[model samples]
Target: MTDVAVPPPAPTTQTRARAEVAVAGVRVAPPVRRQAGAGPSDDGHVRLDGRGAALPLDPSSPFEVVDGRLLRDGDDVGLEVEAVDRPRFYDLATADGVPYEQLARLHGTDVLASTVIQTCIRYGEDDRCRFCAIESSLRAGATTRVKTPPQLAEVAEAAVRLDGVRQVVLTTGTTATPDRGARYLARCVAAIRRAVPGLPVQVQCEPPDDLAVLSELSMVGATSIGIHVESLDDEVRRRWMPGKAHVPLDDYWRAWDAAVRTFGRNQVSTYLLVGLGEDPDELVAGASELVARGVYPFVVPFRPLVGTLAADHPAPDPAVLAEVTERVAAVLRAAGMRGADQGAGCAACGACSVLSTAGG
Candidate 1:
């Protein structure tokens, strides 16, 4: 029999990816301020929820917002966007005078996000990851080092009540415990479930030394998990995140295996940051390995944040970002994984990535 031919995906998907690249890699110009939050966007950014796009509307970027719709350099890009007001939850404070905004903040379109432990064990001058700005917001007093379960629960309830948030993503700085702060995540998940029983919550952390916490998380009502390995290239990991690199690749594989077993395929994921001086071809290969293990590689173009060693470094070129997204999106499609199917978390949020738009 003759081999079957495969038709390409719709052009709309590729077009979406290109738009995402433009938003992510380009800096918005002056006269435009980011609508809210400092965690990731660092400036005025908006999500094209209906069209499945998220981009920063900055001076340097080709995309802009005019009157209530998004345009590509003064032209309609067949996408619609509304200026999202600052989340209502930001205006409230915890009973003890700790602002709820400091406890947890809104991410993307409808996801409530928090870094449960804001300080990282590996964040010291010698051990810190060059690309991480985890503590910049913390030192800036934008957040607390740790969030109590009660505080998170309260914040979660208000976020959903005030802004209609649909999901929650709880992440933490890596701590010294063998659980790698997984236990706290479990507690936070349990608390959030108690407060919002029907809401889905996802947890992110370094792979814990104890795999049992993986099951504990699943049992406690966590809908998904992100065990990020920024770069698959060992050398890149060493140069960028020296401390995490010492953990070894085999350990990460072991963790991925356990996470997949516990959370199920597509529910487990990792962050693959490009432009860390790693070979693009190798980056694609690494993403492929992740897909083979039933893990969704949440590819992010590296952006040098405010206080990291790589703060002066530049983001990846749009062409490189486009290439990686298209390649990895294919892997996800073949594995039958879609970020939206995961129900909750960063991968589910899908704004920071182009894979979901590419039909992954």
Candidate 2:
């Protein structure tokens, strides 16, 4: 894979600049400050979502230990963790013996996200995506096995009412059905909207075998959609997400086109992780292609979170990430697309990607 080095920008006059940067697609306050020198140690730590302390990851932390850096693009921007108080609904339980937290988690200050189905068809060791920890929380008794539609609706209502959640994100584990879990997500979206009308919601799933599933999601009040084709390189797909690789890149393109048609241009997006050994030039080129198609290519760094196969792997060099982000940001800028403009989804949430900091 070829590496493209981006020349560092000229130093700003101020020691600190307050900017709204997106992570996973949500805009948050980032205090961009000038560093005296360049190195991993020079990359200071900040809280994830602005609620926690700026604790450096211990060498033994469950998060991936990549040259002593935490995954999820820690160096790209500074975070001001918003103190998200636990919602009052968390103390209540559904009639069917489920906890609200099991269905959805509060993201940043206002977004609610759920792994609608906790088990993935490709979750076995031989086939699972190395970067996914989808079932780890379930196995550890941290979440319920599967969340019912009613359960999601009930929780969504409570989150919005109690915690002032403004948007919802529904993602599912790939199911055996031909829709590959889009059906479940659509149902969840419908139920949530019915419970709380006009709530902007986003649904994430593997590209369904039937493109019509996207329309179903849109009709159910899914204002945005994420068809995550984590990487564009076939070899990287095979190495990182073996089970998903069988689906073919053509299917993903078709799905993206159909999603844009149904949801409109920037309303459709895909997650493009920057590490994974894909050539940086190819990654940028692939992002440009997606932008041309009117699909937002959300470029994020690969985070080797705890319990995932890649936890011990190293993140891409921070300099490499800065280069990739700047390049992709240029493409998004040309398209007049910003993550916050999407209204909802990971791009709208903006905790995972630094491209938002670059004005993507």
The digit string of per-residue lDDT tens for model 2 on 1-360 reads 224333434322110111112112222212321111100111112334332211222343323213322333444333333333556767768887777766677654577778888889998898888878777777777787788888988998888888788888888888999999998888889999999999899998888988888888888789999999889999999999999999889999999999999999999889898779998888888888888888898876664456777777776655667677777887788779888898798788665566655767
Q: Candidate 2, 275: how far from true, in Å?
A: 1.5
Evaluate all candidate structures by whole-model CA lDDT and list the values in order.
0.76, 0.70
Local accuracy of candidate 1 as per-residue lDDT tens digits, 1-360 = 112222333435445545454445334432222222223344443555463334544456666666555566677666555544578888899889999878986766688888899888888898888877788887778788789999999999999999999999998889999999999999999999999998999999888888999999999999999998888888888898998998988889899999999989889988888678887777777787888888888887776565677767877776667667777787778878888888798789887776666666
Q: Name the top lDDT candidate.
A: 1
What are the models' TM-scores? Answer: 0.89, 0.81
Tell me the TM-score of model 2.
0.81
Task: List the pairs of residues colliding in candidate 1.
Answer: 28-58, 28-59, 28-60, 29-58, 29-59, 29-60, 34-43, 34-44, 35-44
Worst 10 residues of 1 by lDDT: 30-39
